[model samples]
Target: MGTPAISGDPKPQITFQTKGITKVYDTGDVQVHALRGVDLALYEGEFAVLLGPSGSGKSTLLNILGGLDQPTDGQVWFRNQELTAASERELTRYRRDNVGFVFQFYNLVPSLTARENVELVTEIARSPMDAREALDIVGLKERVDHFPAQLSGGEQQRVAIARAIAKRPDVLLCDEPTGALDSQTGVIVLEAIERVNAELGTTTAVITHNASIADMAHRVVSFADGAIARVVVNDARKPARDITW
Candidate 1:
């Protein structure tokens, strides 16, 4: 269902809307419910953090929104298009043209330099920024020629972020983007994400277990038992650099 516009109220555009979304995985012996009737709305140019412990369904919801997976029941919308009703080919195109994903691991090809890694995405994108430009956005211009082995953990993650943003995607979905790094290094990675959201106006959603990171988001959505427990809108968002843990 489409989000109804309120009269005399200027609502920010909804980038994603999910209604009664549910996901069930059959693992032979058990049917695991990954999402339980989740209703969510994400606004354009907003930074949202999905805060929850492991197995809380945050990642499952992200996967659905990113077109990586489908809901077993209910519907999902990306702007005007109904993702749940989309064909496999359409979903593929949707992921390629609009969604950018960053995972817990920096899935970089070890042999490729940072610039080359970013280049892989740019070449396939419909309208892409220069590989160096993408690296610069993540503060990795100097390390563009450096291989993954030459860079630190945070630097490699930044490279992954650069590759994700190179396509200028409408949505950026990050699943535990900073989970592997120390606090200092994690902050650096978050800064890159913050900068990307601010400068490019990408609708960004990040999944994290760290409560401290919630302060950086425009909205914090807490999940529990495969359902959303609460959603807190941050009246005064903190800068990523100021956050610890």
Candidate 2:
């Protein structure tokens, strides 16, 4: 399938853009292509869901957009900055100042309370929200003092969401935020992510294999064989609470 054209009046601001980007992993005697000439644009304050099976390049694209990995060829732009040309120091700074990341696992410190775990990011952030405020946004105000071990799986994921957004990043990238949870718990976690995008106007991109989650996004990009196979613009988006599996 061809790349779908995006249509909008007074075109929305593009938060991230990639042109013909490709990624290749070189093993001892073989080369594995993770992305094959991908071209995509994510708009400001828009919630986008990337849907694909394993090794379809969704996570690889997310990592490159988050500055955790570099594409082997082509170019990437974050607003007006060309990330493909940035040095390692610049990339690190970009990731620190502009991006927020959430993964499947809750990487909270075992010994730190929820608030303390969030405080670690706020302490070094350029301008951060109070740890308590971050927790409140994720519906964990009452559990701020609890450690990760004390919270339920969904609650722990919410705390992870809080930590990622405590810095008030311009973009939020999540790789399978609910992959480890049951349907009910996953819905709660999705609600927290939906809230962040709605409340903070953060440009959010979520990578998921669950097709139902696509119903909650402004745009759904489907990947196949390391390339985008289709893009559907959702005019009637459902709330994350309505999603299942």
lDDT of 1 at 153: 99
lDDT scores of the candidates, listed in order: 0.93, 0.93
Tens digits of per-residue lDDT for model 1 on 109-215? 99999999999999999999999999999999899999999999999999999999999999999999999999999999999999999899899999999999999
In model 2, the clashing pairs are none
Worst 10 residues of 1 by lDDT: 1-10
Off-target runs (Cα >4 Å) in candidate 1 are 1-10
lDDT assessment of candidate 1? 0.93
> What TM-score, computed on C-alpha atoms, does each candidate reach?
0.96, 0.96
